[model samples]
Target: MKDYTIHRGVDYRVYESEPTTFYAKCTQYGAGCDWLIRVTKMSRKFCWEIRKYNGSHTCTRATISQDHSKLDSNTVAEAIKPLVEVDPSIRVKSVIAKVQAKFNYTISYRKAWLAKQKAVESIFSGDDLVPNIRVLHRVFWSYYPCIRAFRHCKPIVQVDGTHLYGKYKGCLLVAVSQDGNNNIVLIAFAIVEGETSEAWHFFLSNLRQHVVTRDGVGLISDRHDSIRAAIARSNGAWSPPRAFHMFCIRHIESNFLRKFKAPYLQKLIVNIGYSRTVREYETRYQRLRERVEANTNWLDRILREQYALAFDGGYRWGYMTTNLVECINSVLKGARNLPVTALVKATFYRLNELFTRKRAEAEARINAGHVFSELVTSKLHANQRAAGNIQVSCFD
Candidate 1:
């Protein structure tokens, strides 16, 4: 085996290599050493069998060096696949250390770096990305292009966070939006130590300062205490006229379920949040009031305008949950396994790719003389057709 040869620090020149047969002889075979191996596929068993093998090498290795010809980048990449999968941003120095520990050979930094690159390419490329739902929040940042792109998206933004995995434990915070066509747009993101007030303050401050700079934007998120504290401390940055912070109805439902452990009553609470008119909301609240008197106080504590659609004016834009941002979280399932450096790189790279591709599509549509997105244009045609069917009454 190649591994055997590398471990033994011996050199072999291959004589034959095939699908079912392999033969090699030691480099010093004719001069002194008689080390050789020959293997052939057994017809009946369909397994390679050693037809001939010299006992052992009778001469010293071809040369004494820290590096081995047998241990190339491909071999090292295969060996470090597990490590890279665990933490793609693992340090090159750490890779060298891992190699030295595993093989008793010191590899150069360049070689280790190359192996890591190869491993990352193989893991993150094509259809092999992290394929589950995980979220994190530690800091908040938006690329200049993404920040600029947000200006054209809907006036609402959704934010969320999730836990990080692997050697370093933290949280990833994200803010996302959607275009008229319902494409999820990642606007800002960051990693933080946890969902603490200080962490949120840092992330939100940067988010407002750099990315979400416009006024009258709707900021949707879960009703986490730290987020509340961060908004309260924002001195109107996240307040009325500047911005409006709303709660994700899904989070409210989860909270309701967790607190009362009443699965049956969850629908009533959600109905209260989803009520589209004051009359409908009052009817829903009355229904819930009849069942949950003691448990309803927490519901009343949060302003209806902040969560209930009927009271939100038009700020909610019919979005009832933080699902858009949570969507960004779901795409990050495997990224949490990376180290800070690698995690950051992978996150932005993929998001940037998404942003770039979408931008090109939008530009292409505009060049083709389209003012509204396909979804909006279709809605306009439908509304116009419906209006044509209406009988208008003249006002006195």
Candidate 2:
């Protein structure tokens, strides 16, 4: 292979392969070059046959190295991307070892790191991020189409934050919603120094302007002091008559678990948060306070309207936890350890794949004449079965 391409000023990469067959193409393939060749060797004979060949190049004679001694960062990125996607903690030394094993040539550790960095850059270079003075403070978001899709989703949105685990120190803030069929719908994301009041304000301000345009939207989150202050400072944009802010029942329960260390208080506090009526909430709240005085003191420190479902007046839709956003966070856990650009790219590609798969599923279901999603259909079936067992009396 080296002797054949050395005189032609061109390089070839393996295009197709079998036990005794090899097909290759010119390295400058997209640069107006049509040169290609195919070779096959019979098992019985020691000779190879030229099955196909495209004679001579219309493009400039390949002037670069033709021996494949040096590999570009892009090539290295493609080779290691699967590894990175599967395990972001994969070491640079491991990448070099793999490349050496595959190509029989060693790459420097710095080159390997550069290859990973380039791969990440390729993923996120498509989006426009908010300009900033500090390299670590940059914030990025989703495209306009994704932002516009929120109009069709539920009028409720959930916001949450998780820590980044790579070289850069920051937190990932995400705004997500639920579709009519209860699927998690991602709206936007941002990377900030931490979950501070200023960071929350910056993230919320951008989210309000670009994504959460609809009115009467309900927002749910944990009772973080910075988040509370940020919502308050939104100047009515996130307040009543415009949007409602609520707290996650699970977060409150976890905090209560830590503070009071009572295993039994968990259920009562959750019941209070999920109570459908003021009377039921009052009953549960009193029981909780009676069981532990510290629980009452803690409950008093939080806003009743922010957590009590009865006070929320049907805004929560029975979602008393931030599990939707937490699920998304878990899905992105593997990507959290990558560089900033790669982290953003991982999300973009994952979401793209998600949207594509879901759209195809919906189309298939519609083609089958389904009236609602499988979730809704299952609920309907259950209700129909229960209705058959109920007896009705005729009025005189």
Give me the runs in candidate 2 sitting further than 4 Å from their true place.
Answer: 1-78, 81-136, 370-396
Please, what are the lDDT tens digits per residue for candidate 2 over residues 71-116? 7666788778777765554677888887777665577777888887
- Tell me the tens digit of each residue's lDDT in model 1 across 1-396: 878878888879899999889999998988999999999999899778999988878889656889777788888998998888666657789889988888788998899978887777776653444678355544456787778878988889888888888657889888888888888878888889999999989988988999888988999999999999999999999999888899988889999899889999888888889998999998888787788786678798889999999989788889999888777787887677666656777776787677678779879978666545666899999998877667343221
Off by over 4 Å in 1: 1-33, 36-74, 78-140, 363-396
Q: How do all models score by TM-score? A: 0.64, 0.64
lDDT accuracy of residue 107 in candidate 1: 92
Once model 1 is optimally superposed onto the true structure by TM-score, how far is the C-alpha of residue 119 displaced, in angstroms?
Answer: 5.5
Q: Which candidate is the best by lDDT?
A: 1
Which residue pairs clash in candidate 2? none
Q: Can you give the lDDT of residue 128 in candidate 1?
A: 43
lDDT of each: 0.83, 0.80
